[model samples]
Target chain A: MDCYETRMEPGDRLILCSDGVTQAGLGQKRYKFGWRRSGELEFAQNIIRKSPEISAKDLAYAIAFQALSISPEKCTDDISCLVIYLRHPRVLRILTGPPYHKEHDHDFAMLASGGANDVIICGGTTASIIERELHTKVEIDLNLMKASGDLPPPGMMPGIGLTTEGILTLSKVCTVLEKKQQDKIPLAAKAIINRIMENDCIEFIVGTKVNEAHQDPNLPLELELRRNIIKRLAIILERDYRKKVTVNYY
Target chain B: MKKITLEICCGTTCYMLGTQKLLQIENIMPEEWKNCVAVSAIPCLNNCTSENICGAPFVRINGEIMSHASVESIFNRIRELLPGEGEE
Candidate 1:
């Protein structure tokens, strides 16, 4: 029973291993390379020597392979390594429905059509409006959407990030967002929601023009209005995820 | 040499239920961890409606989902995985 309390310092190297790596085969002239301290270090240095830029994951695999190759043809114990790294972020902007009046259409279209930010157009009508206003094309991707029932699948515009069904999908997204169940949501919803969560500041560009025809008479009282749903989502992003939720109404 | 990506849920339900308070963690996080653990805000982590029903205030350590997250809870977890190497 040996326990060393050495603390970790930059440039310090440490390795932990099981008997499989250090054990010697009984009654044989063979001794594992990892059986000795020098051999073990040499093994690791050789990996780094071969590829100076190898990632942690690749390095783990390289060591594991060497350990297993000590007796390649047959039995060896389980071997493993853990490597980790940090990450960074971005923002998400969703442009759904349409502007309240036709006059704001040009400005809304121009504002939402620009690049350098991830943009999502939730409603089919909104996508068309943006397409017509900007003279860009929107191609619907029928195969990629989730279980949207009557709503059409997601679409792609010339410069926009994503385009999908409006009311039906938004309602489902709100449900999933409330439920916090990522898998139950469809692909389009999943992508947007994932992006929303993955970022520090998520802005929603909501087109206030109400689409009365798409509303289902059977909808629950809460899901009936697009404004309410978008607002509720904004509140969640603000309160729950702690993201900077900006609602820009067109 | 491991970087922990701490993803906090900023979705409505979590926020409404008080997850907003968790945001302060960014300020109090040990300076050394700022480089090791990159904390980011996410819209929703889905603990509210899942079968487990862990409720609001959720986060993800790397890709592992954690329900009912808090500053103390998250700090303890991060500390375990990355105990301070003397405040770099």
Candidate 2:
């Protein structure tokens, strides 16, 4: 195999494909008399030129779909196209539950204010602590709350990405992530899941505080401990979605 | 009776001005009018031009644009449009 090296800047795209794509439409009537075998390279280049903002995944799909469409009636070799776009990794920090010790609240808030590109505060008490320590008001969207159905609406803080109710929202997120049911997820959970999908790295700051309300027999079975839910979420994100996940406890 | 759809603009300009206060319309609305009005928040309505920016907070009552919208103004407009009222 010949080796070549090139520097890839942000927003640059690199495409690799199997020979099947290049050899596609070879025996078709349009190319029967021509020396050129296929139009795959020109087709992909045209698609790339047409859509400057097209994602790597979409570009690959577009190329592969074109190859398939060129020879729809015949059984051909496996056609695969992989496109890699170079960009900075996006980091999402999720702050959930309150710390076991009250003294750690300030430290937690300080950590939240650190350099993560996106920050989602998950619990009501957790948000209050951040608001008190960061001196930023958390405005709960009443309109979103009403539209959220059973779940509480998300909130907006000055610098934070999203603020939501803790346990219930996380539980719904876990359910949505596990079941892959996008249509049935609540509004707040949908927002969280959307952010999770957009970012490449996920950092979870879980507080060890145990809420006694969750232990009540009257509570639903899915209302597990905060840490347990976070663990499940991290597992699903890492194992299934192949995301980089880190869990830190305060 | 057809319920009146009230969409409040929660875009950046409107939110900064006062959409948060107007969002509480559902909680503070009179019980009698609750059945007739349906309030929801939507993204920018593209009404924040140089001419309309001063009226940052805007709302739409049954697709009619209302600039400089407030709880009281919305109520008065809804009162005017309610069935058996002006209906226009």
- Fraction of true inter-chain Cα contacts (below 8 Å) kept per model? 0.00, 0.03
In candidate 2, residue A45 scores what lDDT?
Answer: 72
Q: In model 2, where do residues sit more than 4 Å from their true spots? A: A1-11, A15-82, A218-222, B1-28, B31-88
Instruction: For candidate 2, give fnat to 2 decimals.
Output: 0.03
Top-lDDT candidate index: 2
Model 1 scores what on Cα lDDT?
0.63
| Models, CA RMSD each | 23.5, 11.9
Give the C-alpha miss distance for residue B17 in model 1, angstroms. 37
Q: lDDT values of the candidates?
A: 0.63, 0.77
Candidate 1 segments exceeding 4 Å error: A1-89, A145-151, A214-223, B1-88
lDDT of 2 by residue, B1-88 (tens): 8899998764434554666678778998889989889887653455655445667678899999998898899989988888778844
Question: What is the lDDT for A49 in model 1?
Answer: 78
Question: Could you say which candidate leads in TM-score?
Answer: 2
Per-residue lDDT of B1-88 in model 1, one digit per residue for the tens? 8688887654434543455466556777778678888776543453544333334557888788877788888887887678463364
Provide all candidates' interface root-mean-square deviations: 13.1, 17.5
